[model samples]
Target: MWKLNPRALKYLNEVARFGSLRKVAAHLNVDVSAISRQLAQLEEELGTAVGMRSGQGFVLTQVGEELVALFRQQKASEAAALSRIEALQSLKRGRVSIAVGEGFIADLISAPLQAFMARYPGIQISVEMAGANEATRLVKEDRVDLALVYAPSPDAELYSHVVTRQPLELITPPGHPLTRLAPLSIRQISGYPLALIDQQFGMGQLVSLVEELEHIRFEPQLRTNSVAVLKNFVLSGMGVTFMPGLTVHSEIKQGRIACVPVPHPVLAGASAHIVSHKGRELTVSAEALINHLHDGMLFFN
Candidate 1:
């Protein structure tokens, strides 16, 4: 069995994160030569070159990528162990990192996050807005403390809880012809050019639902990954879009955009979930944020 030194692993992890050994050494307040020596020792132990000098910086080799995975797994385990011990002490000031989708940011988390900040003034909060795939990737990579994503994974290594259930609705300009209809079906919506989120977005899941209910293929006049752009297009009367109810609530109330319930029952069942990596421990701030989220979710129900 190969023995891994924690210090060397730390050095490697920092190097990988910063993309420069000199920067890693500077952050750690160590000599650059010391970092170089540690990297050499690590490569010797692994019996392969983990990284190579590129101009003024270093780039990871394939072996380095594998080492990074191993190091991250070990680091996560150690962090979990420390967190358990710390939890027994008390929940105090700590940092929490979260990744979420843009739609959820506008609809669900923004207000609660602001309130959380006000309550836990000592706790540091970091948030990253990304697509569902990127959100999941961040959680899996241990880059984020928690992720709120649109889709759920069946993987046993991921723990998921439904934070909120948002019904999908078709939105158009307030006085659009479709607004007069009692309820609009997917087939009827397909008759017009649709503005949709690109396939990478969670909204792309609706495509299958649309296909199941309607025989006609959709021809999207505009496709964007940005929730803001999608809403702008819909509000401008350029084209109609299928979006979560929370996303356009204010617009609907203001009579700028009209939301019609999807006639297909299956389309209404889409939900957003809060997910975390399995076996990972939550920091003090992370746990508090999760509790706040649970409380906020009650409003959706």
Candidate 2:
């Protein structure tokens, strides 16, 4: 068995994250040459290059990424071990990272997130917004403890803790012409000026699927990757957009946006999934948040 030095692994992981030895060195208050030496020794021991110089920085090779992922797993294990030891103290402290789609951000912040942070003030949580594919990749890579994705595709390496039907709706300006036609077809929606997200997002993926199945394409007045922007576009009366109904509840309540159903099977059956890496043991804090979301969030309800 090959034993990697802990210090060397630390240097490698930091370099990979920062994408530059100099940046890692500056962040760690060490000399760039020192960090370089450690990585060189690591590569020599492994008999292969971990990464190569790219543009202005270094990019990891496949082996390099795997090694960084290994370091992350080891850190997660250590955190879990510490959590067990701290059980008597009632989870006094820990950290959790989660990725989410922009559409789910408001719902997460509205309830479960606020309640959890208030209850567990000592536990730190970091949230990042990512597309469905990127969200799954982050959890699988151990970069995040959990993810909240809309219309997530199946993956063998992930486990879904919560899945709920949160159908995609066509968002329009309040009292807009589209509201007269609830449960509109995709072809009908195309006749109006539209705003849509690109295919990197899960909602966008479902929209693309609908277009393919129905053999019709939509020429949108605007294209973006943000649900917030799409919401604003509708509120500003630029045009209609497509997203989950839960995302625009506040706007609907304020009579700023009108959400109508789209009858495509994919849109009608859209779901929100909270997932984690399969077969990995979560720290006590992460598990608690998962339960909180399952029990408290409107997405799960």
Candidate 3:
């Protein structure tokens, strides 16, 4: 009988990832001593030192590294088997997990989710709101079956399908002075106190364009990750912001906000993308949803 159990392997993997047995224990909600004992048992079963303390950190041995690779393969095989068993029932009955940016949640995902739920009420759908970077990471790590993100620069490990292209518009409170202009240049907008998204966000690329055109740095009166907050700030006469045209459409029509076209050097466009791990096979439900999103993009166009 194999002395090392799957639980021990899981502990080893966790320790390797977290770098501390205490952290692994906390994450797994187990006692630190228990994790230590498990590691000792695993090392004894394999007849090798799996990990060693170095400079107040645990470092995995070569044997530990090899074992971790095998353990991950085993886990993946188990997951595939489970997925296959679930898929055998009904594709629509299985769960589909998607990680998406907050900006796309209300406009893009809400309608599709409503329609999908109406058709297949039994299908479980989990939507996690994450930033574009986190969305990419979640999809690549297989934590989520699919992700909706703004396409960043191309990367070899991801396969992206552009769902829709949204134009960026300068948004301000209704009847703001900028609304009177047919088109405004970056320099013209630089005079206002900007309410901008931070540099890590997808929309931050737009700020870079304005910076280059105006040859001056913007000191935002407010910086936020939430589009709703930025919209509210603009509406309340706090500051102006740049956002995708789709996001401000209702407000623009309602006269709560005004959107003006920005000129050439400061032009901004972003594409909504459905991304998946480059070579991984997507679950049936994930594939179905991807197809649905592709179909849905036609309506937006």
> Which of the numbered candidates is closest to the native, going by highest lDDT?
2
lDDT (tens digit, per residue) of candidate 3 on 1-301:
7656788888888887778898888898999999889889988887889999887678999988877766765654565566677678766476778887766766665477778777767668899988777778777556787887763546787787545666567888878888887667776777887888765556776676567766878778888888888888998988799887667666778888888877654354556678887766666667767887776643234
The lDDT values for all models are 0.77, 0.88, 0.74
User: Candidate 1 or 2, higher TM-score?
Assistant: 2
Over the stretch 42-123, how does candidate 1's per-residue lDDT look in tens digits? 8888889989999858899999888877888777767766655656655445677889788877655557777877776766
When 1 and 3 are scored with lDDT, the better candidate is 1
For model 2, the local distance difference test gives 0.88
Q: Which whole-number lDDT from 0 to 100 does residue 264 have in model 2?
A: 76
Single out the weakest 10-residue window by summed lDDT for candidate 1: 292-301
Candidates, ranked, lDDT: 2, 1, 3
Candidate number of the best TM-score: 2
**Candidate 2, residues 142-256: lDDT per residue as tens digits?**
7899999989887898999889999998999988888997567788888888999988899899989988998988898899988888988998898898988889888888888
The parts of candidate 3 lying over 4 Å away from their true place are 1-5, 16-19, 37-81, 151-153, 209-215, 264-269, 297-301
Per-residue lDDT value at 90 in model 2: 93
RMSD of 1: 4.5
- Point out the higher-scoring one by TM-score: 1 or 3: 3
